[model samples]
Target: MRPATVFLLSALIIGSLEAKPNIKNFFSKHFFKDVYGTIDANIKVGDAGKPLILTDLIQQDQIDEAQAAAEVKLDAFLGVKSYAGYLTVDEIYDSNLFFWFFPSQSNFEKDPVILWLQGGPGSPSEYGLFNENGPFFIKDNKLVLRNSSWTTSNSVLYIDQPAGTGFSFTNGGYAENQTKVGEDLYKAIYQFFQLFPNLQPNEFFIAGESYAGKYIPAAAYTILKKNPSDEIKINLKGLAIGNGLTDPKYQVMYADYLIQHGFIDPKSRDALKDFEKQVVESMNNEDWDQASNQIDVELNTINGLTGLSSLYNYLENYSDESDDGIGNLLSREDVRRAIHVGNTDYGDSAVYSYLSSDIPKSVAPLVAELLEHYRILIFNGQLDIMVAYPMTVDYLQNLDFVSAEEYKNAERRKWRYGSDVAGYIKSAGNLTEVLVRNAGHMVPADQPEWALDLINKFTKNNL
Candidate 1:
């Protein structure tokens, strides 16, 4: 984490009628200077310990104008009587750092913090927060609750990071490589810890899906390395990647395997196989465009079959717009809704969203950013052809870890969960790969119970 200079100043009293509070707010008169700059000070209060109070030096006009605009927007976005508060971090370059906090049933002190990362190199974590992975799932224009949210088991923190994605940026001058991303993320985590200083040190684990195969590992490595040697070491437990794209070479090879194994049509198989060879040869010749073109053809073939099912009945309510009768057949509403292209509001939209979102605009070119610092778990749904199990398996196959033998057994073995079948390989202390049965690209979305169980077991033993 980047270090910030701290200054202790005298606390300014607000009013005579109110009690002396540990924290107080003040606005500056400067307009063109930094959006928020703080001079930290030790302030005395009743029983709150000598707390650190950060004074925000912002122009009054700026605060009034921003507050006015926010009030109007909040009236519509929140739809009810609303409360607003602000905190100014001296080190964050952005002037506006806004967030919405909804009341949750779990106690903040008791629950573990679950920081969710959504893969995109450009997409926001909000997609996972409100829909697939977070606490609530919306249905029929109303919020229909979910029983087993990862947040229910842990306190969830959905961050829109790297400066320009979702609600976390200004002017869009974000990091373009994994090193910068890892560094920036460390800053965010450190600041978060300072703000919520009471949180347990070792209860956090980094997690994400899709391109996060890259983002999560990079950030986790940064956190682990930066942790203080004393105290509890911040745990830095383990990482979880769902339907991720960690390595380009393995991804292509896996697509070829899926095709050859009859998971996809013959045309797709042949096209992917031929393209795989071309991509490999192009890489050898350093012809990136040729390799990319071949890969594009393979991907397009897979993308074209978005809603057509290889496992279930094709004519059985194939429309993605509404899940009238599809819920009974599928495990998740997002999966059922994603069965058709028009239901692009949730998971269906993530495919195109990532390809176009801002994170990708900043992070994709920095692929080799954090390879040495983290232990990564790349998981995929066996039924998902987009970022198929073969793709994940292929990526892991090429990783040059010296402890590879320790992470996996000498021979392959089969593991069963209920009615599902998966191949298991463990590398002692480093990695483990187990395919979930009947699961698609979004493993949690397809089989939440199995996903959670796998995660719990993996973290308890590996981290």
Candidate 2:
């Protein structure tokens, strides 16, 4: 209930997120969103023609003078401003990133800002926006207000990154590694701040799920490297990764998880043993492509062994594709025009394929270094089979940080939401790992109330 009073990248380019991040993953789809829509139904905000800007609005006379002399008329939203547009990152490549900015519904000046990145390396942030955490959900092709949107108390910027995800586009070569991805993202972020200097003072954080586990660290490391520069100074703070795929090394506990969850017996576990060895051996051999491929193969094998159990959530018989119906919503001509993407195309398989080779490589070193300074929030759904249990715990318990040992031994305190034991959290120094009960890969979608509370508490250091 407490509003954030504080709140990515700066430079030439910005921002997929994926499912499972093992090559398939999502939500934290928002690594992951932007656009103008309704929150409470009484609002007619952020029409492109009268875009609500973040400048000193109280100075109406000044605004009049600016408007009178303005070359380009802009759109405006009510209360806190909301904007959706494209920011060009690469001139030679003609890469432009699309973004949706929804200001804090509670305290625009105080609440922190968040950049949500959904995983899939290719999953549109729109999946997270409309399907999960953003202010509204698209239902029956209508924008329905989501009361628990994180934007209720904090500004959230959702971007379609790396030019090819969502509405982003580029004629240049696709990014093939974390370094290239970081470069484009940093530039786009720089332009974002350049375009909106008023938000420079707010505390900012980067968050995503699934493959964004890799993207988040890449983005953060690039930002931290640029903090001392004068070109752009983002008031960078913390990070959050939901069911991320940071290190593929310790994350080779697939069959163990399946066995513990009762999805497969020891005999079936034995069947996957050879595949597990291949994954580890491939990773050790530095054949990242093969490693990722083996992991995906292992997962498919598991699915075959255990039919009808969703990879996103074991409790559900159907796989959770957060982007279901999302494309339909975005395909509407009015919707495209509303978001300012004029005749542009949506996402495709290219981004996923572009990142496939980069998938199995470990970003654990970057994560460890990041934990030394910024606070890192690691969370997972109890029912998620994608970035399943033990894998997250395996890496968390082994991180080389100031509080690594303390984190190892720290008591998992019971976390409650309205008298219900919602989850268990273990915290020490800059790292905190939470396991949400009855949830899956897309925590925000499965448990919006808990999702909102998490961002509020984590950003405020109240968790």
Candidate 3:
């Protein structure tokens, strides 16, 4: 029998005789399919934490009723599946950790695990699971299979983390800074590996996008420092970051470059240029709100466009007049559909709301948590102006590295994933930076093939 099955059976046999009648009936009726085998039985506990296992003598009818209620609750969510479950960890102030297991195709043994973190200091992993890199995509307004899902090649764990994002939450007192975020993530990683002792330490890689640039690296650094040597380590492979926010200065600098190169309009160029300067001054003076306001202005201007032609036309053609005009590339409907935002929505509020909402918020803390032990990959889409390629490139160019030449050489090499898209690589110690071409801020949405290829190469050390 499988180890999990064996463990479950032992627990059942030990508790069967003492099990209460109500509890026995409950498991027999409600948890048959949900429980894998004889070893897998649900044991409810009283306030004192005593197991209330079900007995063989319980009527099957009562079990059926209980199981039906559970199925209803589980099916209410988008990605509910057979192996779904929850674990409540009270050691960390009564927080609960929810997980979904995407078992490997055939193997029951310990497999490679990819813990996916979403971007946004506030976005939820559900967006990544359903809308972005998960095994499925929304099509015709329905969820459909994605052939290129990363999980087909590895086990993926989508965590709704921290205390306030997704289903993971605390009644009060959540950590917001890098240090605390890293600590919480470390606890989660430790517990996960502990629960699945068979998972090879070396087969794990940390992956996330956008703001994760900051979170992932910091966490990896912390893990490395704590581990020190390879033998005692988690065998972390590397990290993959998509359209991340690594450095404020570089992002601003590149924004200026993109605008000047015709990727954005002259009016955008003028506005952003002023905004950039103001941001630098604000940063220098430690005036974060002032700097943020400048970005908000630029974002509001971009948000005001109403049609697809207006959106893509501006992207394809750069001019001050073009900024105020609409074209044929994308209609207003197209923009609304692509972003999942509504018509008549303007300003950075939409993007900011998404970022600030419960969805992408956990990412910042998780990234801070994972940085110490794994290699880091910061990937970006070239066409995404909000997190522009030039901005990513600029941020990368400024990282303080141990070997300047190796880093410089890596950056100088032209990045090529396919026939037409162009990119470059920057390697500093274990961290690798990859920029995708002809892609937007959402790399997977714009250039999935290239994004997948880049991930494969980076993880395999082929790039």
Largest TM-score belongs to which candidate?
Answer: 2
Candidate 1 regions with alpha-carbon error over 4 angstroms? 1-111, 228-234, 261-271, 281-294, 304-375, 408-427
Clashes of 1: 12
Per-residue error at 399 for model 3, in Å? 1.2
lDDT of all the models against the reference? 0.46, 0.70, 0.48
What TM-score does structure 3 among the candidates reach?
A: 0.64
The TM-scores, one per candidate, come to 0.62, 0.83, 0.64
Q: What is the C-alpha local distance difference test score of candidate 1?
A: 0.46
Of models 1 and 3, which has the larger lDDT?
3
- Candidate 1 Cα deviation (angstroms), residue 220: 1.6
**Residue 122 in candidate 1 has what lDDT?**
49
Candidate 2 is scored at a TM of 0.83
Candidate achieving higher lDDT, 2 or 3:
2
Q: What is the lDDT of residue 144 in candidate 3?
A: 72
Count the clashes in each prediction: 12, 60, 42
Best by lDDT: 2
Off by over 4 Å in 3: 1-93, 106-111, 140-142, 228-233, 253-255, 263-271, 302-374, 411-429
